[model samples]
Target: MDRHDELAARFEARRGRLRAIAHRMLGSARDADDAVQEAWLRLSRAGGAGIGNLTAWLTTVVSRVCLDMLRARTAHPEEPYGDDLPERAAGAGPEEEAVLADSVGLALLVVLETPSPAERVAVVLHDLFGVPFDRVAAITDRSLPAAKKLASRARHKVRGTPAVPAAEQDRHREVVEAFLAAARGGDLDALLGLLAEDVVRRADPATLPPGVAAELRGARAVAEGTVLLRERARFAAPALVDGRVGLVVAPRGQLRYVLRVTVEGDRVTAYEVVAGPARLRGLKLAVLDVPAADWAPDAPEGSPSSW
Candidate 1:
C-alpha cells in the first residue's frame, strides 16, 4: 500500500478505541464521532514521523476534543445532544440495536454527566480505560497529584457508598433488578410476586398522571401502578440511590427520578419515587457494582440485556 493508504489503515485500526473514549467522555454518539473525526484531521496534518506512540497521541487528541465539547455542552445546555435511550430502543433497527447494546448503560452515563470536564477525563482515562495517572495528567494538563485527586473525586461520585453490607446489597440488587424487569415488561403477576402484601409506593406529585394519587398501598395497587408506567420504565435502571439498591429514571442520561427502595427478604416492601429537582440534587447517585466486562468494547453486540 502507498504511504497515504498505510496511514489511513492505521487510523482505522484505532478508530473504535478512540471513539469509545470520546463516547464515554461526551455521552453522545454524534459528539463522539465528531471528536474522533477531529482527531483524524489533526493526525493527518501532523503525520506519524514525529510521534513515537501513535495510540497515545491519538488518544490525547480525542480526549482533548471531548473535553472541549463537554465544556461547551455545560455552557450551552440548551443544545443537548444525548438522545433518549428508550425512544431510540423503541424505534431501533437491528444495526441500531447492536450499537445500543455495545454502548455503556444509560445509568452509568447519567452518573458520568455529574463530573467536571477535567475530572471526567481523569476518570474515563484512568479508571475506566486503565490509562496510567501520568498519561491522564498529561491529557488533562494537570500535575500527577492533581489528576489523581480529580479521579478520586470523580470515582467517589460515580461509585457512592452502599448503605447495606456487600452481601445484603447484592441480594437487594437482584430483587430490584427483577422488579425493574417485571415493571418494564408490564408483567403484573411478576410484579405482585416481587412486592410484599403491604407494599407501599410513594411518588412525587409531578411523577403521577393528573389526579392520580401520590401514594399507593397494597401489593395489588402498587403492582398495577408500576405496570401503568411500563413505557417510562424503559429508561429505569438499577443504581445506588443515596447508598442503597434503588432505581433511577434517566432519559438520555438526564436524571429525572430516584427510587429509594426498601427490600425485605427478597420482596420490595416499600419504595419512594423522588422527582423534585431539589430532592434529586440532594441524593447521591452511583453505579451498581456490575462487572466491568459487561461494558467492555468486545461484549456481545445485539444483546439487549438489562444493565
Candidate 2:
C-alpha cells in the first residue's frame, strides 16, 4: 500500500482509543471529533519522522488539543450549551452513536465539567487512561508533583462521599430509576403509583411550558406534568444530585436540567427541576454507584461493561 494509506490505516486502528480520551475530556462528541481530527492533521504534517512511539505521540497531541479546547471553554463562562455544532461520533453510525452516548453516562459528564481545565486533563490522563504522571505533567505543562496533586484534588471532587447511607441511597436510586423509566415511557399509571398523594414538583420558569405553573401540587398534577415532558425523558438519566439520587437531562452530552428529588418511603414526595445555568454550576455532581474503573480506558477488558 501507499505510504499515505499505511499511515491512515495505523491511525484508524487507534482512532477509537483516541476518540474516547477526547470525548471524556471535552464532554462533547462533536468537540472530541474536532480534537481527534486535529491530531491526525498534525501527524500527517509531521509524517511520523522522529516519533519513536506513535501511540504516545498521538495521545499527547490529542490530549493537548483537548486541554486547549477546555481552557477556551472555561474562559468563555457564558458560552451556551445549546451551540449549533452538531454532535458527531468519530466514525460510528447512528446506532453506535446512540450506544456510545448512553454508555458515557450523564452523571460522569456533569462532574467532569466541575474541575478546572488543567486538573481535568491531569486526572483524565493519569486516572482514567493510566498515562504515567510524568507524561501527564508534560501534556499539562505542570511539575510532576503538581500533576499528581491536580489529579488527587480532581478525583476527590469527582468521587466525593455520598451524603446518604449506602442502603438508603440504593433504595432512593431504585425509586428514581423507576420514575425515569415510567416518565420515559409516558406511563401515567406508573408515575402516579410512585408519587405520593400530595407530591409537589417545582421547576425553574425556563423549564416549563408557556402556561404551566412553576410549581405543581397533588400527585395527579405532578404526574401529569411529568408526562408532558416525556420527550425530554429520552435523554434523562439517573445521577447523584447533591449526594442524593436524582436525574440529569443531558441531551447528547450537554447537561440541560437536573431533577433534585426527595423520596419519602417508596414514593417521590417532591422534586425540583433545576434548569438555570447558575444553579447547575452550584450543584455537587457525582456518579451514582458506578465507579470510574468501569468506564476508564485502562480498565480490564471485561470490566468495561459500560464503555
Candidate 3:
C-alpha cells in the first residue's frame, strides 16, 4: 500500500476506538457513526499533514465532531438518547451484532444524556477513554479548571449508574454464537432450543429471501425458516449489533445482512434483519476482526463447504 492507503489503514485501525468514544459522547450509534465519518473527512481534507501523535489528533477531531452533534441533539429534542438493546438494534444499521461492545451499557448511556454537552465530552474523553484533562479542555474549548469540573460532575453521575458486567456480556455472546453454529449446521433441534417459544423474526421487506417470511413467530416456525438460512448462515459471523452480541452475513468483506437479536437466558426472543441499501449504509458494518475463539474462521471463497 502507498501513502494514502497507509494513512487510511491507520485511521481504520482507530475506527473502533473512535466509534466507542463517539458512542459514549453522543449516546446514539447513528450519531456516533456520523461523528467518526466527519472526522475522517476532515482528516482526508488535510491531505495527511505530517503531524506527530496522530491518534491524539484524530481523537481531538472526533471529540469536537461529537460535541457539535450533542449540541445539535440538545437543540432538537426529537432525537432522543439511546434505547434498549433491541430498540438500538432495530434502529441500528448492519454493523456489529453487538454494536456497543463492552464500551458502556445502555443504562449508563441514558444517564450520560443528563450531562451537558461539554460535560459529556470531558467525562467520556478524560474519564472513560483516559485522555488527559488538558487535551479534553482543548477539545471542549474550556479552561483547565472548567474542564476538570465538567468531568467531575459527569463522573459523579456515572458512579451512581449501574453497568452491565463483562461476564453477562460474554454470556450474551455465547448464545449468539451457538445460534450461529446451529444455523450453519442446519440443526433444527438446536435452533429450536435456542429460540424462545414465542420468538419473533422481523425483517425489512428487501431482506427476506425467497420463500422466507417477513415476520415469523414461535420457535418451531422460526427454526423451520432458519434452517433454510444455510446459504447466508455459513457466511455469518458474530458481531456487536447495536451494542449487543449479534450476527452479520458477509461472505467476503461486504455486508449482506445484519441480524440484531434479543436474548433472554439462553433463548432468542426477538430479532430483525436489515439489508436494504438505505438502511445498510446508515449502519456501522465494516468486517469485524473477531478472534478465532469467537467463531470458526470463514473458509476461503469458492472453496468447498464455504459460502
Which numbered prediction scores highest in lDDT against the true structure? 2
Cα lDDT computed for each candidate against the true fold: 0.77, 0.79, 0.66
- As for candidate 2, its clashing pairs are none
The sequence of per-residue lDDT tens digits that candidate 1 reaches over residues 1-307 is 9887888898898888887778777766667889999998998888777887777888889989988887886786532222223455455554453344224546566677678888888887776676788888888999999999999998787988889899999999999989987887789999999999999999888777777788999999999999886766665778888889988776544567778999998999999988776777788888887677755564212122210
lDDT of 1: 0.77
TM-score of each: 0.80, 0.85, 0.49
Candidate 3 lDDT, 1-307, residue by residue in tens: 8887888897887787777777666655677788899989888888678767667888889989878877876787442111112222454333353333322423234445557889888876765566787888889999999999999887665443112465776787789888877876689999988999999998876555566668999999899888875545654666555556677654322346778879888789988887775665455422222343322112112111111
Candidate 2 CA-lDDT value: 0.79
How good is model 3 by TM-score?
A: 0.49
Once fitted onto the true fold, the runs of candidate 1 whose alpha carbons sit more than 4 angstroms away are: 1-6, 44-52, 76-86, 89-107, 112-114, 292-296, 299-307
Worst 10 residues of 3 by lDDT: 298-307
The most accurate candidate by TM-score is 2
Candidate 3 residue-wise lDDT at 304: 18
Give the CA lDDT, 0 to 100, for residue 19 in model 3.
77
lDDT of 2 by residue, 1-307 (tens): 9888888897887898888888878767678899999999999998888887777888899999999987887787543332122434356554453344345534556777777888988887776677888888999999999999999988787885778899999899889988987887789999999999999999888777688899999999999999997766666667788888888777655678889999978999999988777788889777776655566653222122211
**Candidate 2 at residue 199, lDDT?**
94
